[model samples]
Target: MKDTSMPELRAMCFADLNNAVKIIQAHDEDDGEAAEADYRDAGFDNQYVLEVDGNIVGVTGYRDVPGTDQCHWLSWTYLQQSSQGQGLGKGMLLELIEKLRSENARKIFVKVSDYEDPELGKIYQQALQVYQGVGFKEEVVSNDFYDEGENQIILGLYLRDDEDQLEEDPAVSEEKPIIRFDGLFEIAETDGAYTFSWIVKETKKLFGKRNFSVGDLQVGLESVKNEGGRKVFLTFPSNLPLIHSPLQTAGFKYVGQLQNYYEHGVHEYHFTHDLNDL
Candidate 1:
């Protein structure tokens, strides 16, 4: 029988980390520890715990998509294994959406992994269905992103109905320019879907000598590929006109955009390259 009692959502405190971590681990032992550590380090301020009759049953939260005020990413949403199939997860999701909507969040996004194992994939499928039932749209999929067979699925929910599009500014020059890379890091990897990230350390060097070129991007892509990365993701401020063409030319597909991500008019454009296809 389903619990007739309603679950209460309350702000989670740093002290509640142990209990929350236990619940998360009970659901996913492999990734729960890392997720708990991440939440403890960076997510304490924005997270909440779901309590039913004074017992913690789940945890949920969202963080502002770095560089965006109105866009947010759903973080470490997990329910205790014992609580599965009780409809509590769906209710908690709706509550989180309502809370974000009230805060005037323009958009919310979440990443779901499609694992190689059939049983594990069903677990993610349930999660995907819950998000879809609440109007979240599938935006992009990076095949073999986690490893050899697992994939990463990005889903987004738009809180507002406004369509705000910006025109691209013309490139000043078409010549390939020298670019430098730094701070290469692995963003995340689960079930063999490895995603790598890096920074553009020296774009200023190309100011007058030449325009950002496709060759500059190819260099970075080749480096990531050499490192055995399955997918490479990069995000740049929409106002940076020179970076756009080189990205498209290097075969990076536009995954999605975060509105007002950098500022009022400037947005953050997300692009991805599938290393397997290369």
Candidate 2:
């Protein structure tokens, strides 16, 4: 049997990658591959290894979110099956949270799957509890995110006091504006999933006719369809008052949201379109 005593957390080295994959693979094969890919893509600079008697028992890390200077997303956190049930996961994660807080980080988020199997018996639920116990707050929930039954819950932990962080929506005014499709791109993390970026041009008049309509959204849907994407995801800042009308008219559904993803109190509202529906 492996030693499970005297756990230590250390920076993971390149040599630890293979061993970490094996440890996680013992419990989940797909996640093992994902962990490897994440390390290769982002490097292991922020990742840590939790060890027992110098043997790696757990891996955890955070990655910076694009367009945000201080916000991060937790990545590929996992543990050896044997090391579980002893609070090592919580200890390791708490240490990571402290590290983030000390570094003047703003917030950290994690996406957890609500997947349960008869054999596994609500495995991810325990992870949810651990995260919540460590002060993570639920931000949004996307149903059927991974499959027909499994849902995705996004949680956030604020490392700093956010009472003064809220900002007014600068783009929204008393005037009508021009909204247009900006571009389309695949969500690198999921197959058949795509997102379209858009541009909203602020107008000068208080009563200018609304330049945005269902046509703008339809154009984006066509781009997704042309790219052979089955799903189109549109996430806008919740502070925007104009996006909802066009999106609803174009057959998009509100699925979920990510809290404060754009700016403080300006959350990301999730909308989805199924190309296969037609």
Query: Model 1 over residues 1-278: C-alpha lDDT tens digits?
Result: 32346575789987888988888787677667887778757858779999877888889898886656588889888888788898888888888888887887888889888764655545677888989998988766766566666667888777766543334533323323333444455665443223334444434553543454677667766776777666777776666666777777789888776555544566567787877667
Question: What lDDT score goes with residue 223 in model 1?
Answer: 73
How many residue pairs clash in all the candidates, one count each? 7, 0
Q: Candidate 2 has what TM-score?
A: 0.79
Tens-place lDDT per residue, model 2, 143-208, is 655555666788988888755244454443332357666688886546667887767777656665
Whose TM-score is greatest here? 2
Candidate 1, lDDT over the whole model: 0.71
Can you give the TM-score per candidate against the true fold? 0.77, 0.79
Q: Which window of 10 residues has the lowest lDDT sum in candidate 1? A: 170-179
TM-score of 1: 0.77
